[model samples]
Target: MPTRLLLAFALLLASLGVRAAAISYVDEVQPILTQKCVACHTCYDAPCQLNLGSGEGALRGASKQLVYDGTRTEAQATTRLYYDAHGEAAWRRRDFHSVLDAQGGQAALIARMLELGRSNPLPANAKLPEDLDIAITRSNTCPLPGEFAEYASKNPHGGMPFAVTGLTDGEYATLTQWLQQGAPVQEQALTPTAAELSQVEAWERFLNAPGARENLVSRWIYEHLFLAHLYIEGGDQRHFFQMVRSRTPSGQPIDPIATRRPNDDPGTTFYYRLWPIQGVIVHKTHITYPIGSKQLERVRQLFFASDWTVDAVPGYGAQRRANPFETFAAIPAQARYQFMLDNAEYFVRTFIRGPVCRGQIATDVIRDNFWALFQDPAHDLYITNAEYREQATPLLAMPGQFDDIGDLLGLWRNYRDKRNEYEDLRRDTYAAAPLPGWSTIWTGNDNALLSIFRQHDSASVRKGLLGEIPQTIWLLDYPLLERTYYQLVVNFDVFGNVSHQAQTRLYFDLIRNGAEVNFLRLLPAESRQAYLDDWYQDSGKLKMWLDYTHVDHRTPSALYLPGPDAKRSFAGQLLSRYASLDARPDPINRCSNGRCYREGLKAEQRDVEQRLSRLASRPAAGLKVIEQMPEATMVRVEFADGSREVYSLLRNRAHSNVAFMLGEELRYQPGLDTLTLYPEVLSSYPNFLFNLKASEVEDFVGQMQQVSDAKGFEAITQHWGIRRSHPQFWFYFHDLDARIRETQPIEAGVLDMNRYENL
Candidate 1:
């Protein structure tokens, strides 16, 4: 009897040991995953769609299709081995009773694998719970509990998404655990979440807000972006397109923010007079077509022509002023005038598309219609173009003795008086309850500035004081044409300089905002022109005007949008046209427009014919043709000893412009007006060149990597804004030659030449 009892005890102990062994992760299961799964499940590219190498990937796969039964026979009972799109293993519960019985048996083993997979860290601030039950309850949901929904409720315009199925329930629970534990990231933080994703959608809606006067924040953002647009157009005042609209502060409810329609034109009034001005400042300028003659004339008369005069005034009292029109002509730089002509021409050509031979007639008619570009010195140009003049009339008159730069004496006084008057309105004992649209008037306070800074780092300003809705440019200074989107600069110290690092962070934010992508995909191709183009178009050309009181304007107002379809269509047409022009065939005779004009009759005719032939051939090309070249295909390194080492393109597949060496030596080759690189080496060494300027080098490393063979030539650009000092960086170049080479001849020679792609 004693022997039998001892045998029973031994059997019980052995059973418990086997059970524990079956459920263990480190001792029992990880070895299986390492041997069978790690081989193909590593890195971003997971073959067989299995990324078992990373912990997160492993758990994510828990609810995915996997081979549960060793036998691959049709007759064998197959299991629902993987999670569904929503990360739920609901199918598993239905098919495998043993798997669902977590209290004991095989269910326990399955639970152990899942728990082990949960060890991976989630993204920063990602909501995670320690209790498995809580995680399960919260998993497979979108808008993530209270956050995004709460945000949406506050801002009626916040269009947030509610459902997200990017990960599985099990993966989310595991991610939550890691996140709640402070996300002990082994590599990078967790991926985007449903709530964060909703925020992105909300951002888009907010970005698309009407830029009408009614929308104050949107207007401020637009004005800031206009600065970038001006940079691209050139700093010339003639080319600057300024949009000016003013309204009483919100509390005064007498004239609602949206009610001050300048010109009655439906187009202009849509954004200017009404609450929809917010949309104008944000998304409307992106709604472009060929330049409108009426609008251009208004802008030109207000800004460009010398002959134009302010009310009751001769030219500037101190200076010997010439007739605005005659003086403009005497400037003798036909290049400027020709740009004006071309802008008007393109506008008419695009809008009035019947006969090619009628260009002279069209030019004559349009020129005559927009004659304000020449300006008559006799009349009060200010009255005719009051819409634009008011934008920057320096609210306070100059005391004549004050210098214009930095501080125009009368300006501050005017601003102060205006502030005092606005303050008095708030104190009105019987001020009516603020109108709904009143909230749109944006006053640049710290909170408003901070909000904008948090959302965007770049903004636009008008060329003069006023033009159209304030236009803002986002994501400037890239190797390619930066997309123009609505954004606002929240802060700028006096000199208008943002650190390069901060600027980069801003760009990162812009990209994350996704407005750049939307604008690029939607804006007209011509909109891609650099600051020089923006300047040229705006300077002295009268095809579009900053009309304050036109009845036929097409710009949308705060009260109404042209509707999504209209906005999209308008934006799409402009972008398509611009894209067409960008890809247009290069002119055979590459001379300045002035020279081509001077060559006269025969030359102009020939050039026109050639352009026509090319236009006919491609049928699809952008208007402005600028060439972009790829980086380099090879690099030859000559060491101090004079022995040269050459790294040639091995596979024409992933060639780039810049090559980073292990420590400090940056190997670069400039060919065909583009930069090319060798293999970039990343390492840590105190004395190495790499370490000295690691931050600078780090900023450009990603750009260098982008130079694979597939994309040869990309545009190089610098940030142009008040906040950024416009630090120049080589575009389409491989290495930072300034650091390694003394002469720095590459920039001087290449400045005028078109950067070409490496073929």
Candidate 2:
């Protein structure tokens, strides 16, 4: 064919509404799904197990099995993408049905869903219709190809990107065309740059050095960082890797040893290999950890430079695997503590976001918001005294070491006894030494101070104390910190039976109380009991399990500060001490004495920000709407010039105590609730979105204040809320996503809309 004739033929094909070029799944299709679809379709709890975050996930398609089921009597088979099953045939045998038809005989199920959404676009700027159930607990109707037609006929609005805005015409056309052509996917393999390869080689050599000590250190590091998106400092920011235990050695193809837990035995000689992450980074699962020459040197100083010996490499026995102190006993306790403290935020996030994707059962063990302070390694008994570490090692056994349904009560009782013994030993150890004051708190690094916010089922951790003084403060020492990691991150089983899951949740209750009691011991002796009573006010029988009396109130304070409220005074002092390291003051939320401004704030912007900050005030009894507010709401302030700023309005729900696993509603104390305002989104999931013009800011605030009933709330949302039904939702979402990536590139990822409310 001649060039001119070929061009004429291509033009004819284009004129006939035929795509002359094949769609690039990597460049064209995946990006569309990431922005519009993946938010609700990623992670363990992805609706109907349809994870569109990767090509394999799409090919594997949807399943009716619920990953977040808490009622199962037996452990479910793990179906993790890329790990549990290899290819489409394997997934099909595991009961997954394809959403895309490869033969192209029938319109693919996904194509049909998208068309149904387009044909019956949602009503604009209003609450979603009652028929469209968007609740997190709503039953999933995972229709296969044969059932999709009947499914769509009954529920016209039930489509891909369900209850949200339909895709743009261009996006829809591109996706439909690709599905029409058998949904062919041409995925490009991730190639590491020369620098990245060099770094990987260097790290692998360091981790796999020919020595038992080196092997033990590598095992410890891999267990702690298995979930991390590891990257070498000064390398490409987009490229990230996971440190996996592989049967094949370095330089060979990575044959990952897929175990339920990071510490599970590989059943063969294994090497630590860096596996490049080959999927879109979702905020809920992305945890970034940087390694470089400096980090490597630091590790050497912490583990190798110290005068310590690894008597023998530890086995992956259940008892040793469940106790880090036992497994890594040869490593200096101070070295281990310092390593974790260096990246406290990342470690905290590992347990908070790592184990279970949608974990209300696990998360309900904590208060809605709290400040976390670490005890200095110098003062921490477990770090400084080998005797204390030895005594606490055997007592540190955690639940889920064995996932047996019959052992539920037995495990709980056994753990409870060990916890009691450990508590007594801890109190005696502290009493034997002079009671330290604020000096006991860790101040070696910026990670010394942290703020943890539980946004309902999901949570976030940030360095440096944030927001107003929280209801509870945790003062963690070495043992407490290491146990937290072992119990939650290493031992938690997302696919475990109800018994295993319940035991994990129940055990964390003891950990939370122990940390809280540590903080209470620092307060005035008279005030210690009062604080515990208030924190555990309505706990009926659970108080026995909490064992609040174990707190040593007889110990006198070494330093005295004169104040009516000693707890508040101490927290304020701690906050001021680290204020220099606090994250840059959020322009919207940082207000004092009726003034609000950051270095770059304009006078007009400052005025609006100061006024908006008033919404952060503690809600009075009459502000009934505060009780109804979602966990997180992103408020966008649009200026007349079209420039806008986004802020998060967090509803910090108060509770008598987060003790009871169930009956969370009964524990809610709405009158004591408060709201926190931040300059940008602080949560991975935003429940509602409100867009207001700079001029309408006051009206928006006024209406929010006056809203007392659901009707009034609806009125406010009808006027200002960017409901999923809004035609411009994608525009707002894209803007928010771009802004986050621009401002916090390393930490930013696609915000999840799985919890986006119908209103």
Candidate 3:
């Protein structure tokens, strides 16, 4: 062969190979559609309508067709032809058949083309039809079930609807069966092995690939716990205790709102049940007492009784007679002021060491620092500057020293240390083995801290505190702190949904405990500054703006630069504070924009009023009168049948034939000391209907004897049509006359013993 002839032959061979690799509808696309799209996309009864399973029917629709890639129709796509014209020279190619013909002995080429087009494979448990019609159409020639009724007669249209149609349902089934049996190439061609498919299948299983474990873990921890943020009635004293403890006439459990946290204690176990949600703003003063006072009282009352448990108080023994909430609340404004002053004194004693600290001057300085620290809503850890303290600390001082600048200036390091130590002495109780340089201990990973707290387990605590917080934290901004707490709750279901309502209280406790461990661990600012002074010889350069008084820095002593300078810092600070840019009132001004704040206050008031009104509107189940326990505000009663119980108000308790449970219902008694029960029991189900204000407790019974199992119920839970997770046999018969006028109709009374068992 001549050199030019040889080059031309090589070019021809390359062109043929490229054509063989291309994904054509006939050779590559049809099979994928048949396996995946047809099951849901096609209507079996409507054969003449669109059938996505078939290439011709899939793309030939006239009105709002499915897959239009700008130019070609699905029917047109069935053909393997491409036209190329240059002036007078026109060339037409039948690429699919040509590639197949050229690569007649190359089964690998065909298999590779199929592999490239099959990007996402169907799952192993995919639902598929038993029988399907495969239409093989090319240009004007078509083969579709509806079009091929008359195969023999040809009136130019070939007795077909459109295009050339060929395969019948039975013929297609046989072809599919043969194709699925390895779609064998000629004997001379190489046959791909099953192992090759295993690799392909593994690669194609994208959803369940490498990163899926994390997603699965996340879904498992968080998907079911329902959360709602709404204003509670009558401020924080909403009586959810009565609501949760109510029972139905049939002695069934009711309180659906109760969110229980995981319990790990070896001895006594307790659930952090649903309490009335209370909201609090950290800096705001007045909103504090109204919301928190009643809650503290309730928590104290519950824990004081034999039912609940609380581990400790801020600076007191765990077994102390006084509740921390009460102790904290009992401190008069004067005492609180003195407490802050005493804290300041302690801070001065520790850091200044040799006192240049005049008592009043020290108090004034600490107050200033404390105010500055409190002003920073983000609560960037440590009022003083410290770096890398989140992972490792240089010295142990106190929380507010870095965070409460007012205290820092008023009282030095010495005072801070003493105060912290004193608080630690008050709260520490040994529940685990001692570790080096630590008083009390617990053992758990950082991820398990919230759970440990929920379990109130000391060993678990030692474990959590021993490990590092997976990522380095620079600053402890309120929002970021919240994010960490949220993740903790989600991963461990720690406080269950209890923390959602008590976020402020929980975080305060966490910070307090952290302070007990090492005050510096909780606040890095004090240490960060110390680190900067130690490392940066050119710290003077960074100090130029230290004197500037911007919006953030109102004092000459304070530095207001954004945290972790992009150029100079090595460790990024946790100063990821979300700066508010919108029109917020000048916080210092009592009423910067009176209208907005007024409206906000009004809105809050309206919300409380509305909630209270709705709660008040809830029909009292029944009345009761207490005779023996005249002073008891609420009384409990057991029903005659022993199936139901309720609580009622004391006055109502004495008047009615029944006794009450926590003051909400009348219980029936059949005997001498008989408590007469009401005809029906009521339990409140929150968030049931649209736009409804009141809580609802629709009649519930042992699984309705015979009820309509809504369509798609079993299908969703089924592995296959034949097997379901919950299965039952039941029939309900309705009393038609009684059901006619009722709003919540007694449609039918179900009598399914299996229904209850299945549930």
Please report the candidate that would top TM-score against the real structure.
2
Error of 2 at 70 (Å): 0.3
- Local error of candidate 2 at residue 391 (angstroms): 1.4
lDDT of 3 by residue, 1-759 (tens): 654454355446555653222334544445544333232233211122233334333333211221212122112212110111111112113111211111333332222222222322222232222221222111222222222224223322222111112223332333333333333222111222344323222322321223333222212212111121111234322211111111121123222222232111112222112223211110000111111234334422322333322243223222111112232322222222222221221221122111111111111111000100111221222221223212122122222112232343343334334334433332231112121111111111111121011000000111111111111212222222322223233222211222222222222333322322232222233444343333222422242123111111111212233454421221112112211211122111112232212134334333322322221111123111111111111111222333221211111111121011112122222111112111111101000001111121111101111123433322321321111011110000011111221321211111101001110
State TM-scores per candidate: 0.18, 0.95, 0.17
Least accurate stretch of 10 residues (summed lDDT) in model 2?
584-593
- lDDT by residue for model 2 over 1-759, one digit each (tens)? 654455456556756877667878999999999989988888988999999988999999999899988899988899889898888999999999888884336778888888788788877877788877788888888888888779988988888778898787677767866786679876556789899999899888998888888888888898889989988788887889999888888899998888988888888888898999887888888889998888988998898887778778988878877677888888888888999999988898888766367868668999988889888888898887878878988888777777678777888888888888998998989888878787888887777788888888998887766677788999988778888888888888888889988888888888898899888778888788778878887673467544433678798877575688878888767656767766644434434545654566776667667767767756547567787789888998888777788888888888888877788889888887887787767788889999998888888888888888888988988999999988899788666777778777877777789898987
Ranked candidates, highest TM-score first:
2, 1, 3
The CA lDDT of each predicted structure is 0.23, 0.82, 0.22
lDDT of 1 at 613: 25
Q: Which candidate, 1 or 2, has the higher lDDT?
A: 2
Comparing candidate 2 with candidate 3, which one achieves the higher lDDT? 2
> Tens-digit lDDT track for model 1 on 201-228?
3333443345332143333223323222
Report how far off residue 198 is in candidate 1 (Å).
64
If both were scored by TM-score, which would come out higher, candidate 1 or candidate 2?
A: 2
